[model samples]
Target: MGPGRYRFPVTPLAPGQAGPRPGGGPLAWIRAHPRACDTVLALAVFVAILVGAMAGPHGPHGPRFGERDLTVTTAVLAAVASGALAVRRRFPRSVLAVTGVCTVLELLLETEAPRAPVACSVVIALCTLAARTDRSTTWRVGALTVVVLTAAAMLFGARPWYAQENLGIFAWTGMAAAAGDAVRSRRAFVAAIRERAERAERTREEEARRRVAEERMRIARELHDVVAHHIALVNVQAGVASHVMDSRPDQAKQALAHVREASRSALDELRATVGLLRQSDDPRAPTEPTPGLAVLDHLIDGFVRAGLPVDLDVPRPADALPAAIDLTAYRIVQEALTNVHKHAGQGARATVRITRTADALTVTVLDDGTGPDGPDAPEPGGGHGLIGMRERVEALRGTVETGPRPTGGFRVHVRLPLHTTQATHQAGASGRSCRTGETG
Candidate 1:
C-alpha cells in the first residue's frame, strides 16, 4: 500500500491455541508469537535511540534537549514511531510511511537534535523488504524514499544541506537495499543448482533402464538360435532311431548317438549364454568355446545327419573376423538352417556361402524345397528369424535381404562392413593388451 512496503499476509497464531512445538528454531518462535516478537524488536530500537540521544555529542556542552526535561510532544512522537514498528514486517510500506512522517516532524519541530531514531528503524524495514522482493521494486521504492527524506532534512533542519549527518542517511539506506538484494540473489542460485542435480539423477535412472531392456532382447535372440536349431535336430534324430530300432539295430544305434551329440551341443550353448549373467563374485564362466563361422563344417555335419543336406563354403581371412561379427554370422547361419528344417519339407538342399569383398563380408543361405513362404512375405525386421539377423547386422551398420526366391525356395543375404568394425575392435584389444602388460 505504501511506496515499496508490500503488505505480506501474516497469518497470526490462533487465539488460545498452542503453536508449533517450542524450540523448533528462531523461525518457529517468530511464527508462534508474531506480535510479541514485533513488540520486543520495536522496544529494542527505541531504547537504542534513547541511549544515543542521551550520550551523543550535543552543541558546545549543552543539554541535547536544551535545558528542558523530555517534553510531552517529543515523548508522544517517540512512542508513535516505536509503536508503528510493531507491524513493520507485515506492513513495511505503511511502517516506512509512518516513520518517514515522524522523522520529518522531528527535523522541523525538535530543536536540539534532528538526527532521529525513527530513521534508523526505517532502514531496517527497507532492508527486510529488499531481501524478500525483487530488485526493481526495491530500487524504485528506495530511490523515492531517499529523494523525499534527504530534501526534507536540507530545507527544514537545524543543520546545513551538506551536513555529514544528512549524507549518512543516504549512505545507510543504499547499503540496506544492496545487502538485501545480495541475499535474494544467493537464494536463487542455490535453488537452480539443486534443480539441475535432481534432473540429472532422473536422467541417469532412465538411461540404466533402457540399457537393461536392450540387453534382454539380445539374450532372447541368442536363446532362440541355440535352442531351436539343436532341439529340432535332436527331435528328428530321436524319431529316426525309434523307427529303425526294430529293422536295423546298427542304424538305430548310430541315430541314437547323433541324438546324444545334438543334446550335448544344446546344453553347452545354453550354459555359455547363462554364464553372461554371472556376477563378479561368482566363479569364472565355463571355458567352453563359442560357435563361429570356422565351425560351419561341424554345424553342417549335424544337419546332414538330420536328413537336410547343407553345402557350406567359407574362406578364412588372413586375419580373423571381429568376435562380434563372427558370432553374429554363425547365429545367422544357425537360425537359417533351423528355419529350413521347420519350413522346408523333405528333399530340401541348402547352400550357405560366406564371401569377403574389398569393404564387406557377405553371407547368403539358399534352400530349395517346398519352402513355407510366399513371394510377398516380408523381409528382415518384420519377421522372426529375419528380425534377429536385421538387428545384429544393423547394429554394425550392415544390411539384410530376405524373401521367397522365384526359383522355388527362401533366400537370406547379409552384408556387413569390415573396415570400421575390425579397426575399432583392434584398437580396443590393443588398449587392453597394453593395460595388461602395464599391470604385469
Candidate 2:
C-alpha cells in the first residue's frame, strides 16, 4: 500500500498460533513457518521505525521526525507497504516491481527527509523474487532494483551522498536475493538426482527378466530330446512282443523285458528334467549320466531284440572325441534308430555304420522299409525328434543330414569331432578291432 513498503494479510491469531515478541527478543515461534516469518519480520521493522520516530532521538545519530501532514502521510504509507508483503510468495515478481516503484517515488516526494521503513519493503520484495526465479533472472532483477533505489536516494533525498541508511538498504536487499537464489538451485539439483536413480532401477529389472526367459528356453530344449528317444525305443519292443507271442514265446518274453526297461529309463529321465522347478531347500535330485558314443553297442542290441534285422560297422582303433562331440554323436544315432523303429514295417532291416577319420567320426543309420513316400509309413508324432537331434549336433559344432536314400530307404548321416577324452580311453585299454564293415 505504501510507496516502498509491502502489505501482508493478518488473520485473527488462531489458537496457539501467535508469534514471539518483536525486535529480536524471542524468534522461536516464527521459525516454524518461513513465509509467516518473512511477513512478521517486515511488520516488526516497520513498527520499530514508527516507535523510533515518536520517541525522538536519544543520541546524535537518531531520526528527526516531521510534524503535521508530512508525518501523517508517511505513517499511512509505511502501514500499506508492510501489509502488502503477506502475499509476496504467491506473487513475488509483481510485488517486487510494485514495491520498488513506490519506494523510488516516495524518496523523490520526501526529498529532504524520506522514511527509512519504506526502503525496508523494497529489500523484502527483491528476496522473494530471487527465490521464485532462476539464477540469471534473479541477478538481472536484483541488480536493476538496487541501482534504481540507490540513484533515487542520492538524486532527491535529504540524506548525504554516503548516508548509512541508504547503504544499509543496498547491503540487506542484495544478501536476501543471493540467499534465496542459492536455495532454489540446491532443491533443483536434488530432484534431478532422484529421477536418475529411479530410471537406473527400472533398467536393472528389465535385464533380469530377459535372463529368466533365456533360461526357460534352454530347459525346454533339453526336455524334448530326452523324451523322444526313449519313447520310440519302448514302442518298437512292445510291437515285437505282440507279434511273436504264440510262435516264439521265449523271444517275445525278451522283447517285453526290453520294453519295460526302456519305459523305466524314460520315466527316470523325465523326472530329472522337470525337477529344475524344485525349491532350493529340497533334497538334492538324482543325476543321470548322459548317453555318449560308447553306449552305441547297447542301443543297437535293444533294436536287435525288438526283431529288426541289424548290421553294424565301425573302424578299429577309434580316435578320442570331445565330450560334446561324443554326446551329439549318441543323440543323433538314438534319434535316427527311433525314427526307423516308428516308420519301418515288420521284417525291415537297419544298418548302423560308424567311420573314423583323423578329425571326426561319421555315423550313418539306414533302414530298408517304407520311407517317407510309402503309403503305410507312420505319421511322425510331436515333430520335434529330428529337430532336437539337429540342435544337439549343431551345439557341438557338427552337422547332420537326413533324407530318403536312392536305394528305397531313409538314411540319417551325422559327423562329430573325435579325439575326445572318452573315446581315447575306451580305445586305449581295450585295443578292440573294428566291427564288421560290409553292407548287409
Candidate 3:
C-alpha cells in the first residue's frame, strides 16, 4: 500500500521475462521433439542388441546370445516402435498397442531371427502410456501386454516357460509402469500444493485490504470529533462577541478573548491530527505527547473559565493505564466538557467523577445545565462527539452510556476494561497482575 510495494527490486522482473535459455538440454529437447526422442531411444536399443550379437568373435562367436548375426527384421521392428514413440503423449493408448504388437512379433520370431531382442523401445512406449493414462487403463494394458509378451517368449522362443530371461521381461515392463505412475502422482501432488499456496496468498491480500479500510474509517472518526468539538466552541464565542460588539464594549472584549482562545486550541489540535497523517520518518511530524487523564485538571480549567463550573474528581492509578484506554478516557472527558459549554445554558454546573478499580476504570459526567433534553444528542441523528466517544470505547472492548439525567440535565458514563483478553490470560497464569487504584 505504501512505498514498501516498490522498495524491493527482486520482484520487479516478470517470470520467463529473463534472457533466453542456453540451447535445449536433454529433457527440453525430448519435450520439444518427442518423436525424435522415441527414435533415439529405439536406435539405442537396436545398437545395444547389435553390439550384444557380435560381442564375441564375429565370424564364429565363442560366447554369444544364440547366434552372432545382425538381422533385418529386428532392426526394422525396433525402428518402427521407437519412431512411433514421438506421438506417444497425444496417442498413448494407440502407441502402446502398436509397440506391444511389435514386441510380440519380435518374441515369436526369435527362433528364426538374430540373437538380439530390441525390447527396450517397447518398454519406453508402455511407460509413456502408463504415465499419461489413468490407473485402470494402465493396469489393464500393462498387465495384458506383459503377460502376452512373456507368454509369446515362453511358447515360441528358446527359453523355458518359467525361464529367468522371460521373467526379466515381465519385471522390466512392470517396473516401467510403476515408475511412470509414480512420476504422474508426484506431479499432481506438487500442482495441488501450488494451487493451495496461491489461494492463501489471495486471502492474505484481502485481509490486508479489510484492515486498511477499517483504519481509515477510524481516522475519519477521530478527525471529525476533534474538529467538531473545538469548532463548536469557537463558533459560540465568535457569536457572543458579534452580538455585544457595540452594546457592551467590555463584555465584547472578553468574548473576543474567548474566541481567540477557542480558535488557537482548534488550530493546535488540527495540526496535531494532521501531523498524524505524516510519514513516521518525516521531520515535520508532531513530537507532542498525546493528551490523557493526567491532563484532566487543565482540561476542566478551560470549561471553568468559560463560565460553566465543573466539579472534577479522579483518582491516581496505582498501576499505569494502557495507552489506548488512557487516551480514550481523555477524549471522552474533553468531548463531554465541550458539549456542556455548547448546549448548557448560563448558571449551569457540571460534575466529573472518575473511579479507578483494580480491574476497570469508569468515567461519569453529569451536568444540570437546564438546557435541552440531550445536548450531545440534540436530534434523532446523533452528534459526532458521542459517536466518536462510543467508537473509541468499543474498539478497546469497552462500553459507553449517555442519556438525560432523571432530575435535570445530561449524564455521560463510560467503562473501560483495564486487562484486555490477552492481559486477562496472562494474569490468570501469573500472580496478582493488577494493582489497585489510589484515591485522589
Over the stretch 158-229, how does candidate 2's per-residue lDDT look in tens digits?
A: 467577667766787788789878767665665555456555555666755654554464456557656766
Per-residue lDDT value at 330 in model 3: 87
Off by over 4 Å in 1: 1-43, 46-113, 135-145, 156-158, 357-360, 372-384, 418-440
Candidate lDDT values, in order: 0.72, 0.67, 0.69
- Compared with the true structure, model 1 gives a TM-score of 0.72
Question: What is residue 423's positional error in candidate 3, in angstroms?
Answer: 10
After TM-score superposition, the amount by which residue 13's alpha carbon in candidate 1 deviates from its true location, in angstroms, is 24
Count of clashes, each model: 1, 23, 2
Distance (Å) between predicted and true CA of 3, model 2? 65
Better by TM-score, candidate 3 or 2: 3
lDDT per residue (tens digit) for residues 1-440 in model 1: 22353333322333122224437788897877879998998898877656544444456774354233454545666777778889876777777778778778877777665655556776777776776677898899888878877777777664777786677777887888788778667665655555566666666667666556666767777777788789888887887899899999899999899999999999989998888778756777776666888788888888998899898888865578777777778888988888787677668899999999878889999999784467633243333565666767766667778877998888889897887656454332221111110000
Best by lDDT: 1
All candidates: TM-score: 0.72, 0.57, 0.70
Q: Where's the lowest-lDDT run of ten residues in candidate 3?
A: 431-440
